[model samples]
Target: MTKEQPIGFIDSGVGGLTVVKEAMKQLPNEHILYLGDTARCPYGPRPAEQVIEYTFEMANFLMEQHIKMLVIACNTATAVALEAIRAALPIPVVGVILPGARAAVKATKTQQVGIIGTIGTVKSQSYYQALKAKQQEITVTSLACPKFVPIVESNQFQTAVAKKIVAQTLQPLVHKQLDTLILGCTHYPLLRPLIQNMMGDGVTLIDSGAETVSEVSVLLDYFQLANPNPLKKRAIFYTTGSTALFDEIATQWLPITRAQSKKIHLGGTTNEI
Candidate 1:
């Protein structure tokens, strides 16, 4: 593979843009190709087999474009599909969980950590496993905020109603005595303000996507895949859902100018990129 090849990233929805935003900042010279399966979003509640199928579908599509590396930006997908995809693909693969877990381990002073994510992610206990692997004495409290993805995907994360929902959903963890909380899903960072307000001032919120990009940087260097020269167009976004909504959210969250998000259909031999 050549250095100019774009790194590929796949997510359940626009939530993965959170990771893309960080990649832009941390790896400024690399081109990025991102896909969001917004058409079948909230993969959190779906069966593991289905999530795996969909994740590979997205990963395979990016592989066709000859990406130098693959970042599984969805927590649910990473929990279920990271290993299989890594074994099957030729390129390097990175997932969000381990990095986020490591960050939480580093930030926690009380050895107590809280995790909030989608149902699938919570059910998989991926964060709990990763955190314990890092620090056996760490205390973890995990919750599934299934309502969150819809709010972010619908572009309602900043609304008053969104705040109410976040407050209500996070009430269970208020007294958990956590000094650090890992926003286990990429989408959760968009609601960072509300989550921080609900969790109060003592708790540090870990954006897993940001941490994942750090690993991606290291991997690029280790694999000798860092792009020496950037392309004129730094990023291309694709979604299985509405391109307009994807473009709108990308504009607000990304550092790029005139973010062009296109539509992509999975399970087909041909697609529009």
Candidate 2:
């Protein structure tokens, strides 16, 4: 694969833009292609098989564009489909979970950590397993914030409504004695300010999306995919839902130019990108 080819990132919704923002900052020379399955968003509650089907469909869409690498930016998707997709794909694949887990494992001073994600993500036990795999003795507490993604996706994260929702949802983790919290879902990073506020100054928050890009940078170099003799960066975003809403949220959270987002359907083989 050549560096000229864009790096692909996929998520259940605009949450993946968090990763795109970091990639733009860390890999300024590279191009980015992102697909948000907004049509079937909040993959949190979906069955694992359904999540995998959707993840592969998104990956196939990105592959058609000749991406050099794949970053599964959705926590639920990473939890359910990362391994299967990685094995099937020829290109290098990266996911948000391990990077965040690795960072959390290293960051926690108390050996007590917290993970907040979607229902599917938390139920799959991906983050907890990933954390334990890295360091067997780490104590983990996880919560599924089913309400968080809708707030972010609806472009209400900075609103009082969103704040109340975050506070209500995060009440449990506040007293968990955790020194570090993993924003396991890509969408959670969009709610980082609210989360950080609730978790307070003493608790460090880990954004899987942000951390995933660091690994992306390293992989790009290791795999000889770093763009050389680069030009101005470019980003192309696609969604299966309303482009207008995606544009609104992405403009505020990502480094992307505020343009009309392209719409693409990802389902059975009959669907087109």
**Best candidate according to lDDT:** 1
lDDT (tens digit, per residue) of candidate 1 on 202-259: 9999998878999999999998999988568889888899999888889999887777
Cα lDDT tens digits, model 2, 54-80, are: 999899989999999999999999999
Report model 1's TM-score to 2 decimal places.
0.98
TM-score of each: 0.98, 0.96
Clashing pairs in 2: none
Question: Model 2 off-target regions past 4 Å?
Answer: 269-273
The local distance difference test score of each candidate is 0.93, 0.89
